[model samples]
Target: MDSGELEHPPAEELQVGPILLALADDNRRRVVAELYERSDGERLCASFDLPVSKSSRTRHWRVLREAGLVHQRSIGNGLYMRLRKDDLESRFPGLIQAVVGAP
Candidate 1:
């Protein structure tokens, strides 16, 4: 193995497969687009105008979080979610650009 591989956590290497799976869903793709293209910064779960119900929205966020596409932090009764831009950029170059830049 290359010495550079040692610098990344094993979990980091595992993110792509899950991220791809998460993006495969239409709702999850929309979620990513909203966060990546619309939101100015970290946003509450309730802020997104997703088509899904609240409970379903939570599940979607969980998928994104598990995929390492979003960073979720609990704040009181609400959860704040932000796109893992740096991680995604480093792991998959041009992906965010393609998704966000899509017309």
Candidate 2:
């Protein structure tokens, strides 16, 4: 793995507990919701207009990455992220839609 890349669990290793915990945060969920709407491509971490402090945003990203909900890679001076939608769907069918589409 590249040194600039963050560690992410294998798709089959995605557990419900971690995923639920990560999504429990409104900020993280908001990120996921926005990611859900995007096509399959990485977006810069700064692109999300999250209403949180830089430290908090970092924490949210860590949680999401650690939970295997997203994959993050550092490129140049920016961090890029992409939702692990396909992985999540494969591990827990319909979970992404259920979470992002929830009322």
- Best TM-score goes to which candidate? 2
Quote the lDDT for 28 in model 1.
Answer: 83
Per-residue lDDT of 29 in model 2: 93
Scored by CA lDDT, what does every candidate get? Answer: 0.75, 0.90
lDDT of 1 at 49: 84
- Candidate 2, residue 102: lDDT: 92
Show how many residue pairs clash in every candidate, following the order shown.
0, 0
10 residues in a row with least lDDT, candidate 1: 2-11
Those runs of model 2 whose alpha carbons end farther than 4 Å from true positions after fitting are none
Reference-based TM-score of each model: 0.78, 0.93
Model 1, global lDDT: 0.75
Worst 10 residues of 2 by lDDT: 1-10
